[model samples]
Target: MTREKSQSIASQKLQQKVKGPVAQELKEMVPNRKSHQREPRSKDAASNSPVQASVQSIITQIQNGKPNVSGSKETPEDLSFVMSSIFPKETGSVDTSNLKMKPLDYERPDVPRLSFGLERVLFNPGVYHLRDPRSRVYNFDPYLGAIMPVSEFDFDALKAYITSSKDETLAGIARAEKKKYIGSSSSMTSVLSHFHYLLSNWRGVDTRMMSQNFPDHMRSFTRLLRSPAAMFLRYQNGSYAIDADKEFDSANILMNLGKSMEKLLTLPKEDFERYRRTHENKISAEEEQAIPEAYHYSTMGDFLMRSQLDAYDPRLPGTGMFDLKTRAVVSIRMDARNFEHGLGYEIRHVQGGYESYEREYYDMIRAAFLKYSLQVRIGRMDGIFVAFHNIERIFGFQYVSLPEMDQALHGQTDTSLGDAEFRLSIGLWNKILDKVTAKFPKRSIRLHFETRDAQTPFMYIFAEPVTNDEIEYIQTKNQAEIDAYQRRILNLEPKDGNDDLDETPASPEKPAANSQPTAEQNAQPDAQAAYDSSAPPDESFLAELEAEEADLFKGKEIMAMTLVVKNLVNGSPVDRPMVFRADDKWTVEYELSELQGKQVSRLYNACQTRREKALSGRGEDEADAASNVYIRRLRDLAMKGRAYRAKQDDFDSKHGTVVLDEDV
Candidate 1:
């Protein structure tokens, strides 16, 4: 058997021994039972079973009185009972002697301090002006309605109502107020009434909970029914009264609406942009603008209103303004084909094709970071670009790390960021503070970038130092191997059919016969000649020459075989080739005579064996260690070449095939 085959068998056996029993056990425990069957137990019953005697002994001890002890010690049973029954109650009582009650003052405090920055501007402008005296102008409503009665609008009561209201609604109102003043209408009144009703009847008929209990289709139908009611409340201006019981029953509808709105708000800006861009191509500009504006006002009005109330001073340096998004990271990804095209493969006028593409990506990121820093006071920043080839794999990245604006100017790669090129670019900004704390003695600023997919070319920037020793080590090893392989490839000499076969001097008669053939003799090809006159007799010639050529020249065929080795970690391929030369003995007398007379068959067999060993993963050096013994055997056999048998049985039983002899 070949060494490779033998090794494979051994490996299989070892793996089977290690994993066979465990696999079998798993299969048995989690057998392919019907879905109705109970789930399998995680532990074995026998292993988990407690000793009956030990349990009885413990029980008996617990039941019996303990030996006398000085200090009090609670028994396990007594402690269990005490813990089970320890419910405490509040008496709602106070000590009259310590409590002092003072007359209430209806007047407001002499000096009012503004806890929130925007309160002065919002209140001073009289933005709360209302048409109805009953409709008070509150900065934000704790309840859905602005018409809470004075009796139910105390500080604690207001807080409880607000706390109980949907968080999304409160947030939406806050956002809306921030953008524009919120006004009351009939729709708002209905919404307030419905919200209060729902809160009152919260115990029963919750449509949201009911939907969760029902199938998907049913839930969807319920949602459709509830959507109009929600929209009416958000947009309609009609007075509508909701029964308290009915409100409680349908509380789930409001909750679901809030959830849906939250989800809509959470969508990424890029996704929104993509949707808007795609739709813009299909619809007229006027229609597109109208739809978004109407949709925003109808659905997001509350949020916009809140935003107006909580506005911050945009003129102040470092103040984050809503419209200013300069410091935010932007990511770019390119497929392999697009990447190549951008590099100037299609437009050959550009010199550094791939490199130019990489540089462009870097420049874009740098420009974005710089712009963001200037506008938004970005302390550190990153930009990322990802390039993809085939979607499945074959992707790489180019990364540029700029630790800070200063570092970027100096053109130095940061060492504190991660070694991953994609991460260093995009996520660097997000991790700047973390990296700074870990690396610098004093606090410092940083930025980072990261790419999501591995199957694309990517570029990113980072502003932190990160050690990359592991990456350098891998690169060094690969380079070393590649260099060595190149040297070996270059050193291989081209072989000729008539090269000196041995260093030993030929005898006088042999030397005389070895002289160049006469013109007439050469013109009349000798069938017994070892070298083919028509062939160039070099490696290049041999490469072009097929098995048929060997048969035509040597009156026998040559065999070739290939074996592939792969690196287990990275899945890189390694190729190994084996060649054997053979010919029929009768047609070529000199070749057969030389082989039989010098026992060449044995040497050929030994070489084949060594080739197999090397192909089986044994290093070339290991195979070479046995070369001397094989060569000596071959030398002895080559001397008796003519006496060799013609039958396949003799060749097969002695040596498998011709093998190349290698130096130790």
Candidate 2:
């Protein structure tokens, strides 16, 4: 949902319902921790102080949770500590026969409960069925090609869905491309990556820097920890988020089958036959709109979840919210170049038929089902509706209900084990929230998790203060603010009797008094094919990125384009039009601030998109050449802002949000 729409919701009751600490602003919920300061102390005093002692005690408790193996014990999550359990096996799959669990004993609890107590479901989570990728970029507004209308899903709604067929019939229907979405939701990876720890690691193992059970879990961690600048980049400048291009990710044909099958099953056989004939007759190049994505945001005890649903059918068994899964028959080949990230794959669109992948189905199940089943039970979906297909064509489909997954994962299909896991998961989240908040309060932090074989898993976390580079940038911003304040105070001062009125006429380049720049200052040069007329960005957009009330973007999604404008080419010749010329690089990188970074990137990409079309020599494509002229006009404006920055006569600082590190 777009921030404009969220701010547009006129219903006071709906607004009030979602207002509170439990469903608080995303940033406030898991806050940033500032670096610490300490007074000098004797060795004994330092070791024995309450603050030091408690910190150590807390770490120990988080690493080694409550006892669970004796005659009587509790298997509670690390209270107050958020942990990502690492499975020591390849593929994160484990025999469910090893799980050992018990009902939690809160009477002897050692951690904090939620501030408002606990509940299974949260307030209205505005669910929008995502019909297209463009919708994600723009608002779920009606003017665009939005499939689902944006609105709050009342308590009665928010179930789930999936579609599976029993045969190869979907193959000849003509294939279409599925866009990048598997890693689209970072929240999904954050919330669901710890299943191996919950379901199979009966004994919490220290898993830091060890072999991981699933590739994506480790990959997410690596990307998040790449650099200090990257840690908060999503919040600071995320208009576009680039996802890992993975194998088995963009199976367009399979995605089509999953989206279409459930609804097709509703049609009569005669209608189906006619529809099939039309579908198979000839495939069009245009892609079908993505089905509406149903979001069910609910709270389970300490857990706050937003289940993204594919479809919902009450007629189907169990909650009827079947998770949609598209299983490709091809084997994965890991890209090991970036070793810090355990395993990732190159982006390749596979083209193959039934015989090519049939023999690989059993192995695919072994590699994927554990992760799949864990998602099913955790989200509490009815089950998973998996559509089987090779990249080229559909093979068959199957619906594995929760009971079936339970039976496969555990020895029984009864809800007993699934119930235990669910309660346990929520309890873990509750404990994590309490402990982490207590330890860091409102601070930015980095967490490192490790689970030793048969040993307790530990999370090592630390706070992040503003970086020196960021500090330097802000200081420059600060100086500009000071200059602006001085100018305002001077202008407001009682002027000498005959001072300003008789002064020489102001130059066209400098406005009279404290006033807006004249048309001459606004009309910048460098009116090449890649620049725009508008110059510097307003300072307010990049300063103090926080708001009193929170929504999805947390009040700072002013930029939505993630592409850097320097990577649009295909092979070696690929480098030709994709990148800016060498001289244009330095001005963009060192001269402009992050806000201008967004503007120039947008300006340059627009120029290239036009250039690429024109270069193709298509007759109608010359329109791109005209648009390039205006785009360059904007680019030049951004560059001029850097030169004029010393005017130092604009903007308020909003009391700069940066916290000074004690060590610095």
Candidate 3:
């Protein structure tokens, strides 16, 4: 096929795929139904009908060579794209067997006594009462029999009752059992089926009763059996209540109750036995003696259990004690702001306005402790133990220094103490200390001071023994402050010296202030005396120097001087043999020479005149031109003398220079 035809066929196939079987079905279903319907359709229905029409139009456009009717430009589907679209690997399948299968080797143990004192009082009150009634007086009601012992008794009987009522409970049990297996299914269909079965079969009363009555031994097992099914059902239906009107089947409930008892059963029997042994003798003695008005009964089992969980040491090997944290509200306050007094007034106002019941409780306890101890070492003492009853979350006890605690307690809201932030702060402190040490290498006895957050009642304070480097840095900072202050002072000071000079008097009587003496008076005294004592020359010396200067320019021509030189040399000449005077240094005169030597004499005279004028600060340009002309005449004579010799050398020696050979 031709390329165009091939492309067209591919486009047709793409249009068919993009249109999709679902879309075609929707179109076919709607078109005939719409024709038969005489009733007016809602806006939503009417709007949906055109969407299929638009898809069809786009399909037609793709089939023909036309603009896409559907606004979107759809690409043709290749085989790889089709495979990926149909069979997405990431979320396509899940191995549910691993998720649903219970751990095979974990056997349910017989329930033991509840070990925690508080938990026993709340969850197993019957055990607490049976063990010691006198310790259970607060808010007590005799009619509402203790829940633990009663539940335990009923739990055993309920199981027996369930085994006997097999026919009545079969449907519920079968459904529950099927739910358990179905919970293991990987397909969405199986999961949905299991969920529906759970909703139809699950009995809330049975579940709740089992949970209430379940001993510690059975708790894990009960949760293991029932939790997944309940969760799956709740997720599907979006609610906990199913079959609200019907009573829960007792058989399945008893089975769940039996399962929950597993946790209590798993507790070490030796621990309970030890408690029983330790307390039996004491109880008997108390009974034999006159009964006291009040008594406190404690158990070794409870004590050991608590100590096992709560005891932690920083030095403990492999404990990872520092990493463990109990979730608790941590209050942080800026003690530095407090120390600054009114400087941070806005922050202070905020701190004053904010209050929490927890803070109040903590404060009360702290005050009571202080009152009892006189001086409490807060850092050494474990702060508090907070327990989350509804959840398994636990918090550890910690205490911070007084100042740190004060800072934390005064200013801010509660925030979690992040391990990362604490570690970062420590690292920063170490780096700062290192830098300080490096800066002051010579200082052996250095003390460093730093500020850090206190954990308990979170606060900040000056931590001490600062290094020499730290002190020097602070000193440098202070010096900068001082320099700035000095500069400001300097700028503010008046410009006294210059201003005073401007205001001074300028009288002639003040020796013509700022003016220099005339040249004759300022001349050296010795030179001046010599000049005064000696009589002036009879003009002969001056005439001789002038004649000598003229002889120097005798051969020079006047017209040879270019217009540039004329303008630069003499603008106008005086017709005179110009005489120049010098003080004991020299003298010169240039006059007309004999008439036969007029040209040479005139040129020489002109040159000398120009020279003398220049020396006496006249005709500067003329003097420069005369000097240049003299130098050029000398250069020309030298060049002419060398030309013949140069030519001879070039011809004979094959070199540039030629020397003239005189008649030797």
Q: Output the number of the lDDT-best candidate.
A: 2
Q: In model 2, which runs have C-alpha deviations exceeding 4 angstroms?
A: 1-195, 202-292, 332-365, 443-450, 455-664
Candidate 1 C-alpha lDDT tens digits along 185-215: 2112222222211111111111231122232
Worst 10 residues of 2 by lDDT: 585-594
Local lDDT at 654 for model 2? 38
What are the models' TM-scores? Answer: 0.13, 0.31, 0.15
Segments of candidate 3 deviating more than 4 angstroms: 1-15, 18-21, 25-113, 120-664
lDDT of 3 by residue, 511-630 (tens): 222222222223344323222222322346434534653453344321111000000002222111112111111111111001122233322232222222222221111223224553
Model 2: per-residue lDDT, tens digit, 1-664?
7533432231222223332321232112221223323344465543322223222332333333423332111112221211111111111111122222221211221211111111101111211111112222221221111111111101112223221111111111111111111112223333333423322332221123222322212111121111111112111111111121111111112223333343333333333233332334322222222223344433344333334555455555555566666554331111111111211111111121212222222333333444566556545567665544322223334466666554544435565544454444444433433343344343322221211111222222221222324323322422433333333322434445543311222333422332212222322222221122123223363222112112212322222111011111122111112222222211000000111222322222222222222222211111232245533333343344334432311321332222122222
Clashes of each: 79, 41, 34
Q: Rank the candidates by lDDT, best first.
A: 2, 3, 1
Better of 1 and 3 by lDDT: 3
Instruction: Point to the candidate with the largest TM-score.
Output: 2
lDDT at position 621, candidate 1 = 18
The Cα RMSD of model 1 versus the native structure comes to 40.5
User: What does the lDDT read for residue 623 in candidate 2?
Assistant: 27
